[model samples]
Target: MAMSLWNPTKRNSVVLGLLSPRAMLTRWPSQWIGGALADSFEACVDVQRTALRDAGPAAFDVLIGSSWGGAVAAALIAEGAWTGPAVMLCPALSELRRHGAIEAIVDQIAALPAERKAQCLIVHGDADETIP
Candidate 1:
């Protein structure tokens, strides 16, 4: 989970931040962007099933994810686990092949409700060296 608080005093909004694999290892982009966003920033090393589910509905207002994190965000939304909107930057959906379960993930994404799919925003950079 990645989140930055624009105002620590104001807990009305929470934005989940998903970090890239590289960012997770180095804590650069994650820390830099997350730190600059707001004071309520939180980073999740990994999006585990129990943890994400336990976070409940009020845990985040929106999700912003990069690379692998974006894939997790997409999976969560596709599985009907998350209802809020999402912003995926260079989502590594293609990397699912490495898990030997890309089909399962695709099926899950395909099963998403129309309304749920409508709330997501996916941005893939042509020059993205990581996912590309």
Candidate 2:
């Protein structure tokens, strides 16, 4: 999902933000149930990466993603597609394992320079079965 906020001080300036498709599932369950699960995990991440790259990292002040979206954000960061700050809420890193990409993703994240990893903040709840 894409969101834009008007910047009151800048006349017509708008702050563009990108959110994962899953983020809307709660509010729009029917939309998700219809066909949102067709895409592969990697395919979804690729779409997100392409959008972020097209917008350029400078276009966004920060990236925020939840659940599977959080995983996509982390994957983009690990792949060097996004260098901006990010807030990941209960990222489903284990989903990568299910798709057989966990090792590579983990390796990429581990190989990142300390400074790059520091740009992301991850929050996982103790009660989150997906991550726990």
Task: Give the C-alpha lDDT of model 2.
Answer: 0.64
lDDT top scorer: 2
Error of 2 at 55 (Å): 1.5
lDDT for each residue of candidate 2 in 68-116, tens digit (9 for 90 to 100):
6787788888888888899999887775555344567778988988888
Per-residue CA lDDT of model 1 for 3-23, tens digit only, reads: 323333333212322232333
Candidate models: Cα lDDT each: 0.57, 0.64
Candidate 2 has its poorest 10 consecutive residues by lDDT at 10-19
Worst 10 residues of 1 by lDDT: 36-45
Q: Which candidate is the best by TM-score?
A: 2
lDDT for position 56 in model 2: 76
Clashing pairs in 1: 1-44, 2-17, 3-41, 3-42, 4-41, 5-39, 5-40
